[model samples]
Target: MAHITFLLVVVIITALAFDFTNGFHDTANAMATSIATGALRPRVAVLVSAVLNVVGAFLSTAVAKTISGGIVNDGLITLGMIFAGLVGAILWNLLTWLLGLPSSSSHALIGGLIGAAWVGAGLRAVDFYEVLEKIIIPAFAAPLVAGLAALLATRLAYRLSGRADEESVTRGFRFGQIGSASLVSLAHGTNDAQKTMGVITLSLISAGALPTGSGPPTWVVLTAGLAIGLGTYLGGWRIIRTLGRGLTDIRSPQGFAAETASATVILTSAHLGFALSTTQVCSGSIIGAGLGRRRAQVRWSTAGRMAVAWLITLPAAGLIGGAASAVVVHGGTAGTVAVAVVAVAAASLIYLLSRRSPVTADNVNDARNVTVNPQPAPASN
Candidate 1:
């Protein structure tokens, strides 16, 4: 029992580490557009996002319940399995972060869990039907819904204010971006932080520290909230650069529209307990906003690469999780140590490589010409 306690402790720490990565990895989901449009200074944007992320984590546990009970059979998960799963997620989050690709951290966590569960206890351990109904369907549908909503909202925002002076209009929308971006931050907390809570809860249940069918404990919610909040404060400048500049040249109006659309979709899914990808929703909204404005160029090449990352996120993370699980199950504590050392080494390397072309707050908006490119072809002729 003491050994089980020790393993549970390790698993919990690993889970929190993944939550930290998730926070920075997806900070762009909430704050990118606002920063791009100068609605908030980069530091101010992340500070607000960090506080709201903690506040948002307390709003709902429906998503948490879904994670603890819905995706995999709780009976089969071991502490080591949970640890392995998180390693998969953290590595993937770091890899994508290095590339400035806004891939889904939520999907990486889910895929890692599914892979570890499947490998640790065979295929029966996973609930494929629930994964389909809850995760997969939402993954495909949320982005499209968010994109269309943002497109419509962007058009409406423009049409309603078309006769107004351009300076006044931009100023008004810049102010509006602050509020809309905050909503996205709040929605993101409710959706994203809860996944970590679920993982911790699942670990407790597996170790008999908590009863089955239990929700995350109060302490679990608090710590997970704090960990993610801290990470958000750090910000993911690379991804912020990608979403704020690489996707399109966003104006204040479009930034406001995209943020509002993203918040609505994310909040709705959280309420419904769907573990959809907030990254994809925000990215799609940005794309939709780009398309909504007349003559705005949407960079298809950057977007195409992002799409490819999304498509591959699940399988790639799953493979890593599966391999880690196999190692843990067969090699025991030594295997767990081996995986940890390797994950740390890989993450350090990625961070070093990222320093080669660092995207920091000071120059986050060093504008890229999305229209006439020295790089990929523009979406517009």
Candidate 2:
């Protein structure tokens, strides 16, 4: 009993740690465009995002229920498996952040849980149908739908204001960007924070502390919200640079359109209990907004890299999770300790490497260093 209690404590703490990483990693999804367009200062953007994230966490538990009950069979999952899965997710989040890649934290968590469950309890432990209906399908569809919406919105926004004064339009949209970006931040909290809550709830269920099919406890919700909020406040400056400046150059109008589109898609998915990737949704929206504007350029190079990262996020995190689970299942407490130590060490190394070329708020909006081909000049009559 004492052993089970101790393991549960460890699992809960590790789950919160993963939640913290998810917060910072995905913060760019909400505030990147606003910061990029100077609609909000980098620090102010993150602070607003952090507060809205906590408020958003209390809005819905539908996504949390999906995570706790929809992914894997709780009956066969163990505390060690949960811990190992968190390790996998955390490592992937840190790796992507270090590289300035905006991969899906939702996918990382899902893949980690899937891999750990598969290795710990065989294939039968996973609910493939639910994963398809809730996770996989949403993963592909959310971004496309959000992209199209953003494209249309951007075109319409420009069309409606085409004859208006450019300066006034820019200022108006810059102000609008704040509200739209805040919506994205709130939507992010409602969607992403629930993932950690679900994980913690699942762990409690596996530990026999909570009944099977139960929602996240109140304390679980509060702590998970706080963990993620704190992480958001710290900011993921590396990823902010990537999303804000790497993918495309954003103007105030496009930022407004993109953020509005992203928020709508994310909020809808969360309401439906689909664990959609906010990063993918927001990235797609930004690209679409770029395309909608005349003469605007999308950095296909940076975008291609991000797409590749998204494609591999699930399988990559899963492999790590599976290996970690195998170790824990075979070597027990000692193995868990060893895996945790190695994960911490790896994370530290990545942080140190990132410091060599840090991306802080002070320079997050520095001129784009990557060379992009200039759009060809329009042909003269």
Candidate 3:
């Protein structure tokens, strides 16, 4: 029993660590466009996002319940399996952050859990049907829907204000961004924070601390909220640079439209208990906004890279989780300790590498240095 308690404690801590990474990693989802368009200063944006994230966590537990009960068979999950899964998720989050890639933290967590569960208790342990219904379908659909909404919103904003003075119109949209961006932050808290709560609750159930089908406890919600909030406050500058500048140039009007579209999609999914990817939604919105403007150049190369990252996120994280689970199951407590040490070491190395070419609030929006040379076409003759 004491051993189980210790393992549960480890799993809970690791789960919170993953939540923290999720916070920073996806910070760009809410505030990137606002910062890019100068609607909000980078620091101010993150601060607001952090606070709203905590508030959003308390909104509902429908997503949390889905995670704790929907994806995998609770009866087969163990504390070690949960720990291994979190380790996989955290590593992937850190790696992607270091590379300035805005991959889906939601996908990372889900893939990790699925992989660890499968390895720990065979293929039968996973609920493929639920994964399809809840995660996969939403993963593909949410972004497309949000993108269409943003495109229309952007077009409408332009059409409605076409006769107005350009400077005044820009100012108005910048002001509007404050509210729309805040909504995205709040929606993020409600959606992403619940993922950690669900993981912790699942651990408790596996350890017999909570009954199966139970929702996250009050303490669980509070800690998960705080962990993600703190991460958001710190901001993920590398990813902010990528999303805010690397994808496409954003104006105040487009920022407003993109953020509003993202918030609506995220909030709707949260209400439905779908573990949607906020990063994908925001990226789609930004791209849609870019396309909505006449003669706007969308950076297809950067977008292509991001799409590739999204495609591989699940399988890559799943492989790592499966390997970690196998190690833990074979080597017991010592194996768990080894995995922890390795994860910490890898994370530290990535951080050090990131520091070599750091992206900070001071220069996050400076995309003037970026140059894309167009390929010359072969001579027809």
Predictions in order: lDDT: 0.87, 0.86, 0.86
lDDT of 3: 0.86
RMSD of each: 3.9, 5.2, 4.8
RMSD score of candidate 3 (Å): 4.8
List runs of model 2 lying over 4 Å from the truth. Answer: 61-63, 66-69, 211-215, 367-381
Q: Would you list the rank order by lDDT, best first?
A: 1, 3, 2
Where does candidate 3 stray beyond 4 Å?
61-63, 66-69, 211-215, 368-381
For all candidates, the clash counts are 0, 0, 0
How does model 3 score by TM-score? Answer: 0.93
TM-scores, one per candidate? 0.93, 0.92, 0.93
Model 2 over residues 75-127: C-alpha lDDT tens digits?
Answer: 68788988888888999999999888999997888788889999999999898
lDDT tens digits by residue: candidate 3, 1-381:
988887888889999999999999989999999999989999999999999999999896565554544687766877888888888889999988988889999888878878998999999989899878877788789889888999999999888888557888899899999999998888889878888898788778778899887888899999999999999999998889888888788888999999999988887876775667899999999999988887777899898888898988887888888899999988898898898889899889988877766678897886522222223552421
